[model samples]
Target: MKTLGRVLTAMITPFHADGSVDFDGAVALANHLLDNGSDGIVVCGTTGESPTIANEDKLTLFRRIVDVCGDKGSIIANTGSNDTLRSVEFTKQAAATGVDAVMAVVPYYNKPNQKGLYAHFKAIAEATTLPIIVYNVPGRTGGKIIPATIEQLHRDFPNIAAVKEASGDVNVASEIYRRIPTDFMIYSGDDGLTLPILAVGGCGIISVAAHVVGKDLNEMIQAFERGEVTKAREIHARLLPIFDAMFVTTNPIPVKYAVRRLGLPAGPFHLPMCEPSEEEAAVIDAALKMIK
Candidate 1:
């Protein structure tokens, strides 16, 4: 299985002022991320405001990012949704776009039981030959996929390659590490828990903060892996404020603003996902200054 490197950014979608998908801007941003520190980009994820992006635009964005950055880094498209059939069909389409892999977030709102979750993912896993990253973010999904279910999926499907464990509980990550095979990767879905999860054998992070502090984040990960514990801890401590600020007002809001502040391509947000308030933008500004 090809690992989607150590620091994958759950990238923000760049939009035109008219609220149209900025295809050219997205290409620029993907290259910018690759040029910086991201090993890959997870387009159309939560930070990318997947909920608001149209399906056609999403496919286009996936293809565009892959076209520009596929050779430079991994491009993992966010193709999952709360609907199983829809997710399966979309995953198949996303796979056709040449992404390195596809991530299926745990079904949100319509909380599914373990059996249902298993079946839902099974259908998606069966639909594609590409690697699948099972995204388990309970805070947004309204339910969590237990380690047992993940283990079962890993065992049953070779393509069900990894889990983005963002439940915010280190014990959950530890349990997942204990159950899954060594080859089955686990990624920190929460930026705050990256080091703790790594201590428990996680492979890397699917991060939001990497948009601003990609180089520093990558340095921290490399420091830990190189036995520079103190150095890693120092970097993590310095980045904690930025991590908190990213969530100061729901993800992407602070991150999008931070990116634009850097004079990057991040444009205005789509409906229901507007820009940060004055107070929130101040917090994000302070946090961005922390990046060294």
Candidate 2:
């Protein structure tokens, strides 16, 4: 089991022209994230278009990323699905594939109550030995994983290793942290909120912005770790424009587009996530330039 310490890059899935999984491209990106100094890679997460990727494709990509990362770092497979049983199955599938951890988001669209939430994750926690990072992104999942409930979960379960605090509620996470044991880690679910989350004692970020600006993201955490809050804040503010652009659209839309623009073999975005309008692409272009 990898001790996830700093920034973990929530990877952007690269597609081919035919919309098939770009296995080679995915491996290349994983290698880039590591070489650029990402602490780990969160494969098949929201940024990776998990909704569209099939089970077989996910297994292939997971193995490919693991093969590419090669013990240099860790891999957090996102197994968050609306179906608890299916999520458990996927988590086990990923664990069997040898991922360091599995990140499962709260039930989406079908918004479950705390009791249902506990049941959902409680089942998955029972199913896999891979460390579970409970993902609570109500902005996307349509329900919150309340702080009090999370504390109860941490208390009851030993493998519930981390919480990806993307609920945009720093207090909620801080309260959970104050309650839970120190071994349980908290990763900022929002790329833009890394420093704030870290300031409030978050360990790292499962970052979308890291898709483009990998090393700089790591530096933000390192600076803060070294007691250079001013430098960390400086880097965070400078990178704010990049972070802003990442969420400008519905995530990977802008991220992949920017990658394609950078001359990577990034392919067209799949449906339900169609190409951004010319205006939006222009904004992304400007944002990429700003980072340059």
Candidate 3:
């Protein structure tokens, strides 16, 4: 199985002023991230506003980003959703795009039981030859894929290589670490919990804060790996403000604003997702001042 690297940015989808997907901007952003500290890019995940992007646009992004950054670093496509059949078909399509891997989020809204969750991921894993990262963010998904379920899936599918544990509960992550094989990876799906998750044997993070602070985040992870616990803690403390800022408003809103402020190719947000409020922008600005 292939490793998708330690720090994967859950990248945002850049847009044109007219609300169209900005393919050129995406290529630029992908290169920018790889040049910084991102080991891979997870395009069209929650941070990318996947709910709003069209399927054809997502496929285009998967192909285009892979073409541009495939050799430079990993390019992971988010092809999973609440629907099983659609996820299976999309995972196949995304795999054909030459992306290094695919991420399937825990099915949301319908709140499937553990058995259903197992079946859901089992079908996705069986569909493709690419490595699979099972995303488990119960806060958004309205349900949780307990550790036993995750362990079962990992045991059943060799291709189900990792789980992005975003439950925000360290005990849960610790339990998962104790249950799974050491070779099976666990990633922090939440930026704020990266270090704690790492302490409990998480591999790295599928991060949002990485857009502005990738180098610093990577340094922290490396510091931990080298047993420089003090240095890692210091970096995490310094980054806490930026981490807090990114979520001052709902996810991609503040993060998209931060990316635009950096003079990158990030553009306007689609409907239902809009610009940050003035108060939220102020908080984000205060936090961004800490970068560099």
Shift in Å, residue 195, candidate 3 = 0.9
lDDT string for model 2 (50-97, tens) is 899899999999988887685878888998799999998888888988
lDDT of 3 at 158: 77
TM for every model, in the order presented, reads: 0.98, 0.96, 0.98
Model 3 score (lDDT) = 0.92
At residue 272, give the lDDT of candidate 2: 89
Per-residue lDDT of candidate 3, residues 43-68 (tens digit): 99999999999999999999999988
Candidate 3 segments whose C-alpha is farther than 4 A from its true place: none
Supply the TM-score for candidate 3: 0.98
* Candidate 1 least-lDDT 10 residues: 283-292
Model 2 regions lying over 4 Å from their true place: none
- Say what the RMSD of model 1 is: 1.1
